[model samples]
Target: MRLLEAFRGTAIQLPNRIAMAPMTRGRADDTTGVPHPMTAEYYAQRASAGLIVSEGVWIDQAGKSGPGIPGLVTAQHAEAWRQVTEAVHEKGGRIFAQLWHAGRVAHPGVTGRTPVAPSAVRQAGRIFSAEGWTDTVEPRALGEEEVGEVVRDFAGAARRAVEAGFDGVELHGANGYLIQQFLAGNTNRREDRYGGSVAARLAFPLEVVAAVVEQVGAAKVALRISPGNPENDIVEDDGKEVYSRLLAELRRYELAYLHVIDTPDTEALSYLRPLWPGTLVANLRSEEPTSREEGELLIGSGLADVVAFGRLFIANPDLPTRFALDAPLARADHDVYYGARLDGYTDFPAFDPDPAKFACSARS
Candidate 1:
């Protein structure tokens, strides 16, 4: 029953230790980058999770990655997200918004501006656009002054998320985004204070975290990191040294929780777990799917305070309930995962104990 145990997080108390990992479903309004009505319905359906981390939400127009991604730049965008947070809260669930900036992963077709990164290095692949997948353009290196502006932008976005009623904000420092680009040496080749040594690489990311925590107290902020992850063409030589220095500085912030993605080498979680003083949320990256037994072992062993499940939560709206009852989980359909319709977004039904004898089926 470790998965069902209540967790005391920095910002809010979780009803259970099972969190819904953030996943982009591409169901937002394409033009304005606002979340669709169905997006609220989609999250409300899975409000049973201890904590619902929303899909990556753009912090500004220039930060947008592609079509169908949500933003928090304007009042309208905040209003749209308010509906989602309210829906989750009405069901007695807590939720956090994952504030994101794609950096070099963006394309002009998506953001109408040349992508910016710590360095001019471009990702090794194409990104989705209105015209379909297009080659990634070499990003312009951000000016020394511009870095501070981006930090302020994150603080502004954090304020907007709180205004929208989100319990907290999880700064997306993982997945080779803007933050990770600064952390990885292969992506950042600058000689400025933002790059070179471990302290220099950790400077910008730490500034961003400090800015966000200043806007909304440290208790209302969390960070997600993926050390040694080469996704989006990121390459890091020494993840241990980088993350050790990074977490050592981060320990002073006393944020809500540190959500770590298990690296393919499986060394990150084990190496950085002890460095983090607060709650730790681990997303196991394995060939096999996560199960109740695995979750129990992780929690029981004190390796992870909470466990996040991505695809499993997509198919099972009542994931915690299903785990509690040991019920069969529904398989997810990958085809409609990013479609702009409810077919695969909010249509996944909660588990039924006796479907043949259910009232709706009997009436049908």
Candidate 2:
């Protein structure tokens, strides 16, 4: 299938076109912000993927959203991630650390500080914390000086991710996170240079991306964006202009890839795909997980250079192998999707075909 073919068009060469989309699994130490030992084994199990974008790793303590979310802030956190990188490298797999920051979605109950955003816009949303789910409070509007600090935090985290032995780092500029908070018109209402017009609203995310690219080379940088996604109560009324200008500015840098998260409500994928100059990674959103045929058509049609699978990679660690062998896939348990245990994390075994049973059935 076209999806299983080797990819060489980008700065990063891949063994296949199948990518493991990043998914947040709350399995890290809540206090230390270090990834658990199982985290290493979990990623290594899926080493057959062409590339693995790790679950969101917060850049700073205050950037963390809730318990068990991993961070790359301190030396200890970097060392813990070293094991994960080494394990994947041992199996000849490439992985990228996704840097994340939750702006207004961060609850003081979790980080013990008021959340910060480009403006004081409060979304009617819920945020998880040590005290459990609580109403998201109106965040403190970041001062112009404070904005530079957040940009530096992203740069520092990118440096640490490279030191931790990640193949590269991808800025989590999607799904209504901190960067998206700046991009969305409703979330960003500041009159400063960081927010106002489409150009001003594009300033913060572009600054973060540039800082990360300078910290590491452009060859080691990638970005993810979700346009028209209402996640975390985000509203992008001027999404077309913002995204169009964002992509135009991004083309100035020769980055690794641009990951686009698709929503059924928008034709952003087809609209933006042709605009990107470098390698493009598409996570085509649907009610069900992306199937092999759908992935095949996506790659075959030239809409995306690589196709990323989220839940499919959760259950099928050897997903590419299953696609090649035409074997049955196992279903993942939704209850354990976010937890500290190995029940639904690493316990799901790879596809194992029983030749003996097939032989008996053929004889019968």
TM agreement with the true structure for every prediction: 0.96, 0.97
Q: Write the per-residue lDDT of candidate 1 for residues 92-183, one digit (tens) a residue.
A: 88899999999999999988899999999989988889889889999999999999999999999999999999999999999899999999
In model 2, pairs of residues that clash are: none
Best by TM-score: 2
The local lDDT score (0 to 100) that residue 309 gets in candidate 2 is 94
Show model 2 residue runs off by greater than 4 Å: 357-364
- Misplaced by over 4 Å in model 1 are 355-364
Residue clash pairs of candidate 1 = none
Q: Taking the tens digit of each residue's C-alpha lDDT, what string does model 2 give over 111-185?
A: 889888878988786888887888888988999999999999999999999999999999998888899999998
How far does residue 316 in candidate 1 sit from its true spot (Å)? 0.6
